[model samples]
Target: MPYVNIRITREGATSEQKARLIQGATQLLVEVLGKNPQTTVVVIDEVDTDNWGIGGESVTVRRKRGQ
Candidate 1:
């Protein structure tokens, strides 16, 4: 069995986007790892922007810096 974990900011993506991501991720796992889709586990974690950080900064801050 293969486990896939995906984390994203809570308010950014719509339900459809998340669904598509889950579907595509499972397909990718099946293609690359030869894992059975039924046996594979996919976990999506939705967190607030303040709680999600990268490169020692919050996601909101990162986006602001880029903009």
Candidate 2:
């Protein structure tokens, strides 16, 4: 079994987009690691911008400054 965790900001990502992400991750594991797609686990965690940080600043603040 292969477990993959993907984290992204809650920025209006659509269901179709999320589905594609899960599919793509599973496919990658199958192709590169010889994992079974049926057994692969993919999890996407959408976090609030304020809860995600980078370079000593929150993603919310960085976006405000256009960084």
Candidate 3:
């Protein structure tokens, strides 16, 4: 079984879009690595912008600063 973890900012991703991400990840494993889609696990984690940081700044603050 192949497991894939996807993390994204908890902004405005719709349910449909999240579902697509899961499907796309699964499909990529199937097509590229010959993994079985049924046995592949994809987990999507949504982190708050404040909790996610980059370049010594949180995503929330970075967005506010237009970085």
Candidate 4:
């Protein structure tokens, strides 16, 4: 069994993009981990840009700062 957790910023991506991401992730796990698609569990979490940060700066602010 393979468990995948995906965290993404819910800003510009559409529903179709999200679906494709999930499908691709599942496929990768099936191929690389040798997990069965029927038994694999994938979880996608949509996080706000304001709440997600990197290097002590929020993603929204980082984009504005260009760093």
Candidate 5:
């Protein structure tokens, strides 16, 4: 079984978009790694911008500063 975990900031991504992401990731693994799609597990974790950080600053703060 292949497991893939994708984490993105909670920015109002639609269900269709998220489903496409899961499908794409599964396809890539099946094509490149010869993994079985039936046994593949994909999880999407949506995180708050305030909880994600880069360069010692949170994404929420960075967006506010237009960085």
Candidate 6:
């Protein structure tokens, strides 16, 4: 089985968008790694802005600073 994990900031991605992500990930694995779509697992984790960090600052703070 092939497993794919995707993380994004919790910014209210629509359900359709999430579904597309899962489908795209599965298709990519099937095309590149020859994995079976039926057995592939794609997981999306959404971290809160306050809990996610980049460039030594939390996403919440970064957005506040407009960086």
Off by over 4 Å in 4: none
Instruction: Give the TM-score of each candidate.
Output: 0.78, 0.96, 0.96, 0.83, 0.96, 0.95
Candidate 5 whole-model C-alpha lDDT, 0 to 1: 0.97
Per-residue lDDT over 1-67 for candidate 5, one digit per residue giving the tens place of the 0 to 100 score = 9999999999899999999999999999999989999999999999999999999999999999997
Model 1 weakest lDDT span, ten residues long = 58-67
Candidate 1 residue-wise lDDT, 1-67, digit = tens? 7888998788768888888988999999999888899988888899988888988889888878882
Record all residue pairs in model 2 with backbone atoms less than 3 Å apart, i.e. clashing. none
Please give the clash total of every predicted structure, in order.
0, 0, 0, 0, 0, 0
Give the top-scoring candidate (lDDT).
5
Instruction: Kindly list the per-residue Cα lDDT of model 3 for residues 1-67, writing each as its tens digit.
Output: 8999999999999999999999999999999989999999999999999999998889999999887
Clashing pairs in 3: none
Candidate 4's residue-wise lDDT over 1-67, tens digit each? 6888999887778888878877998899888878788877778888998999988889999878775
- Model 2 has an lDDT value of 0.96
Angstrom error of the Cα, residue 46, model 4: value is 1.2
**Pairs in clash, predicted candidate 4:** none
Deviation of model 5 at 1, angstroms: 0.7
**C-alpha RMSD values across all candidates:** 1.8, 0.6, 0.6, 1.4, 0.7, 0.7
Better of 1 and 2 by TM-score: 2
Which runs of model 1 end up more than 4 angstroms from their true locations?
Answer: 63-67
TM-score of 5: 0.96
Off by over 4 Å in 3: none
